[model samples]
Target: MSKAYNETVALSQSGALAALRAAVEKAQEMGVPQCIFIVDPSGETIASLRMDGAKYLSMHTARAKARTAASIRNATGSMTPEFAVAAGIASNGGVTNLPGGLPIRFGGKLAGAIGVGSGTGDQDIEVGRAALAAIEADPI
Candidate 1:
């Protein structure tokens, strides 16, 4: 039998919150507060947290990173300099090449993405990874 619609896996609110909490915990462990954002496969926000002392402006980048990862089904920061610039401009800053974004997959299905900011790119990635681990999702 063939169906026109395919079953879709989505990120639950609880999963999103768990990821956010785990990301915050990791940020605390690293002594760097951060803005963490989680988005669904369609780039809809699920949960987010801006820890105390985290850069408020960085929240925007975090959102962009999350949306970009979910939209592209790939981790951020892989884009080259030229593509990064072009994509950022083309998307009007909706997408970014920042290193903090990671796609989340569950049961071999794309679930969503997470983005961490207000720290060094490596640190951000570390926090994002912690979030992914918390949800038992496949690492990006």
Candidate 2:
């Protein structure tokens, strides 16, 4: 028998940091405090940050949003209610239906995800999008 291996890309610390900075900048621009979380392709945390005055609960929510994005391989906000029910994502632990989560892609492959919290859903999503744009410029 022959054995084969699967190769996949993962987010690097530098990339995560860049994304985090972008997210923070966006949050600042929007006049909102935030908690940002980034995870690897395997749904492992790479880096996280909580801006001053950010809600304490946002810390856990941000990580959960990142985990959800990594697990579903899609933006958490994009998951429809029906899809969430069909996929049982609504019942999954550490998975959120929040709008802050965004999947990170590299070379057309899923590399990881980023999540932002402590702002309104739309604001959080905006921060996530900014983070994604920064990450796209320096894909790891």
Candidate 3:
């Protein structure tokens, strides 16, 4: 049977919040505050949180990271320097090559994306890993 479309799992608001909570917990454990952002499969913001002491502007990057991950359906920050800059410029900063962005995959489907910021890139990625773990998301 040929189908016109395929139904897929989508990330809900509760899942987004759970990811945000896990990211926050990881940041706290690492002694760094963070701005955690989660976006739906279509790259719309679903939930977010900025821990105290996190850099305020990091929220912007967090959004960018989330959008980028959702858009590409993969982790952010693998782009080369030139492409990263060009993509940023072309997308008008809608996407970014930040290391903290990871696609939230579930049941072999793309569910959503999470973005973390306000710490070192390594720390941000670490926090994001914790989030994915909390949700039992498939690895990217």
Candidate 4:
């Protein structure tokens, strides 16, 4: 038998927008082009943005990073790079399963996630961090 699921609070569209704007602005301040993604608790994308100069290929990787963060509720970097590689996810091709992606949590509940790419992994993480800080949130 299949089980039914009840829904309650979810990641607000406005929240995602605010979070994304903060992140993009941070990246721009650092002069680091980037692709940003915001995904809901279910790992579904809610918002996304790609700054000019950010590689086109980085878009999908940005989404993957957001997916990983939302699903795992942890910063992608918290998981060792080796782990990501073993799972066939890394900077290889269009995959950036690195430290720059992070989850968005509120009131101890999963809200969504944000991922940034197109720059070095460290730069990407910085952008993600700035966004979370703006909202007083964390990656998980």
Candidate 5:
């Protein structure tokens, strides 16, 4: 029988953490406090933080964002709004279905995800993207 050999995998959680810090700092500098979340490949929370001015609602949004990214393995925006609406994605019991959730990919493999909330959707996404970029994790 032929065997399927697997290559060793590597990921820089440190990179992801660094990215989170940088992104949070950037948000702070912009005077936009936010809730940030990071998750592992399996969608387990790795780290999370809420800035002083972040909204309480963002706590749930942040978790939802991370879950959406990990479950779909794509950026939250990847799902067209039309599809999201049709599928009730924005409704209760559906995915977060917002723009602030982004999947983390490394070496063509899903590495993890990041989510941010407590601002405009665009702003949340920007901050999350900054962190993903810092970690060198490809955004899906």
Candidate 6:
């Protein structure tokens, strides 16, 4: 038997680092200490940063949120109640129903995801969006 495969794109390490830096800068601008996480489409960590004074719990939550976005290929907070329940089971508790996670796309493909924590949900989402904007401006 033969198997077929299709090409896929993933966020490069440099791209992930750039996104992390952008999130950090955004957090600083907002005067909010935060934990920022970037992960590949497979939910593997590419880069992460925990700002000074960020809550320890944010470390775990940030990564979980990124994984949730990557796994679902959508913003974590956009999931419907039923989809959230299903995603939670499918991700084995790695999914987070939070507003700070966003799927990263490049060249019309799912590249990765970014998540921010240790701030209000809206602030976190802002930081994540800033990161995505940075990545878009300087692609890898």
Alpha carbon lDDT of each predicted model? 0.90, 0.83, 0.88, 0.79, 0.77, 0.83
lDDT of 3 at 63: 91
Please provide, for model 3 over 31-75, each residue's C-alpha lDDT reduced to its tens digit, 9 standing for 90 to 100.
Answer: 999998898888888998999999999999999999899888889
Candidate with better TM-score, 3 vs 5: 3
Among all windows of 10 consecutive residues in model 3, the one with the lowest summed lDDT is 1-10
Candidate 4 lDDT trough over 10 residues, lowest sum: 1-10
Worst 10 residues of 2 by lDDT: 1-10
Off by over 4 Å in 4: 1-9, 80-82, 89-96
Q: Write the per-residue lDDT of candidate 6 for residues 1-113, one digit (tens) a residue.
A: 53221224777888888888888988999999999989887888889989999999999889989988777777878778887787778867688797788888876578888
lDDT of 1 by residue, 1-140 (tens): 74422224788888888898899999999999999999988889989889999999999999999999988788999989998999999999999999999988886677888988999999999999999999899876
Better-scoring candidate (lDDT), 2 or 5: 2
Deviation in Å, model 6, residue 41 alpha carbon:
0.5
- TM-scores of all candidate predictions against the true structure: 0.92, 0.83, 0.92, 0.82, 0.80, 0.85
Clashing pairs in 6: none
Structure candidate 1, residue pairs in collision: none
Ranking by lDDT: 1, 3, 6, 2, 4, 5
What TM-score quantifies how close candidate 2 is to the native fold?
0.83
Q: What is the lDDT, from 0 to 100, of the residue 22 in candidate 3?
A: 86
- List ranges where model 1 is wrong by over 4 Å: 1-8
The numbered model that scores best in lDDT is 1
lDDT of 2 by residue, 9-115 (tens): 77788989999999999999999999999998777999999999899999988998898888877788776787755554545647778788888887667788888
Give stretches of model 3 more than 4 Å off: 1-8
Candidate 2: list runs displaced more than 4 Å.
Answer: 1-7, 80-92, 137-140
